[model samples]
Target: MTLSKKIEHLEQVLNQPAENFANSFKSDIILFFDDNFSENNTQLFFLNDLNSKEEIQSWVEILTSRFVMKFEAEFEAENDFINDYLENG
Candidate 1:
């Protein structure tokens, strides 16, 4: 299906009552369309942006950050910088 249809489908799925869905669930949604299609790809990207918006309900959280268990010294060194910014700013 096209991106628009995929987005509409997601909205419909999310519309179910709280009891209908599990507390933690995983869904993989992909839009299959030819690259040479005439329509602009912007609409697809826009819909993705909406998915991460705060206006959406509780279950819709965008995994937009790097979720890593561990990293190298370089990454650890920056932790102080981040913490300082958080403390000061």
Candidate 2:
């Protein structure tokens, strides 16, 4: 079916509630809404927020550092220590 027809069908089936649906996508978060339609539009809003980035960076730094220390202790630099440690674990 055509897109418009499908949307219309959804409206009928759902009884058309005036609300927004929002969610996150890994690095991006979005909210679906329509202001111009003043009716209903399935729109996407990407959120560029610092909190998520900070948290992710913090996790990576924490995990990588923890792994690196164990790696260095177990294998010397002459070996492919870093790569091998990660791959083996």
Q: Which runs in model 1 stand beyond 4 Å of their true positions?
A: 20-89
lDDT of 1 by residue, 13-82 (tens): 4444445233122121112212222235442343443443342333233210111222244755434432
Model 2 TM-score on a 0 to 1 scale: 0.23
Give TM-scores for every candidate, taking all chains together and pairing residue i with residue i.
0.26, 0.23
Off by over 4 Å in 2: 1-51, 72-89
Model 2, range 1-24, lDDT digits (tens) per residue? 434444443223233332433111
The weakest ten consecutive residues by lDDT in model 1 span 62-71
All candidates: CA RMSD (Å): 14.6, 18.9
**Residue 40 error, candidate 2, Å:** 28
Please list all clashing residue pairs in model 2, or write none if there are none.
none
Would you give me the overall lDDT of model 1?
0.34
